[model samples]
Target: MPKAKVGRKKAVLSGNHYTSRRFDVVAVGASAGGFHAIAELLGPLPANFTGSILVVQHLDPARKSLLADLLLRHTALHVKQAEHGEIMLPGVVYIAPPDEHMLAGPGKIQLAHTHLVRFSRPSIDLLFESVAGMYGSRSVGVILSGTLKDGSAGIRAIKEAGGVTLAQDPAEAEFKSMPQAAVATGCVDYTLPLNKLGITLKNLYEAGSPKSYG
Candidate 1:
């Protein structure tokens, strides 16, 4: 539907464990000041959301993961960090372990041993690019508050592959660089505010018709 975003490159196949074979995965990327924004998006998605979700947030590798723990408290969806070889499934939340790039494939999510891109191990671009290869237009990608441009290329890849994309409105982001960079790439479909993201996602699922999420 749109051209791929520039700035970096990244790559995958997602098998069907979701609602339908067409599309059943969504990938999200965040960093800098993204905690609240991420919670806002995840809190409203029902536990029955029929697609796999993969998330990567910028975090200190040396620190214990608090993102999944924090999200568990805010949403009904089961949340956990990616294990060595966990399959991608609907109704669950998969967060990339800090300091490692997450790759989603035919039926699972894996922690990559590859070198980090843009100085961040869990690069948003990596996650998005992988999702594009596997899920294509069926994937939905959202880039939220963050510093730097980790997710820009990922968003573009998603777009090129026929996936949909949304970015938090830069004016509404705690750290606008990431969203701004995504928008600048001209591939993002929606640049919504944090408060409006939940409904937007709900709408996307609804648009998918009988293949709805939750």
Candidate 2:
């Protein structure tokens, strides 16, 4: 098969699909032991954080989402399940709905309930790939505690697109498979402990600094 003429799509912040440096979006993925870990990571981020946060957490399609309420009780950022077509806005945390794939667009969002990636709904790789596609190199992707290999491919996509990628230190992860697999892909730029991730996020947003470790 011939390669597509336009290989990777980009959401530009300027002319000719170019984007100036900015920390306007943050995408996080986790599964297995995500509930507790998410609270720990997001609770410390200030309400004034200057980046929009999108999360893809493994969950049952038939189950109710306590995640938004759970995290809301812990963080100052407004937490809610994402609404299709909503633009990314700083200080708001959008959670991916169950049994759906969440994709990022130019300051906007799109959600689908089609095929699953890696046998999971609210697929992490789907979210990461889409975000990297839209944001180019200006996004942040975090792979947290989980028990499978869901996030590695997504992390690779983000890295290739020039986005900063972070994985929780495997040793510190409650279930290390996901983060460890991501590390094995050789794309992770930071292997932070749970505590430091919050601090790092704060620094990234506040200082307008981009940390690329890999």
Measured with C-alpha atoms, the lDDT of residue 59 in candidate 1 is 90
Candidate 2, 1-214: lDDT as tens digits: 1111111221101142212356667889999888877887797799877778899999988998888988889888899999899877778889998888888887877889888788888899988998888876778899999988998898999889987777787887889999999989988876777776776667656656432211
- Residue pairs in collision within model 1: 5-156, 13-106, 13-134, 15-106, 48-214, 49-214, 137-162
Which candidate gets the maximum lDDT versus the true structure?
A: 1
Off by over 4 Å in 1: 1-22, 209-214
Give per-residue CA lDDT, model 1, range 1-214, as digits (tens).
Answer: 3322232120001122222424578899999888898899988788777777899998998998978888999887898888877677677889898788898887778788688799889889988999999879788999999999999999999999987888888887999999999999999877777666766676566546323433
Tally clashes: model 1. Answer: 7
Model 2 gets an lDDT of: 0.79
lDDT of 1 at 106: 74
Taking all chains together, the TM-score of candidate 2 against the true structure is 0.86
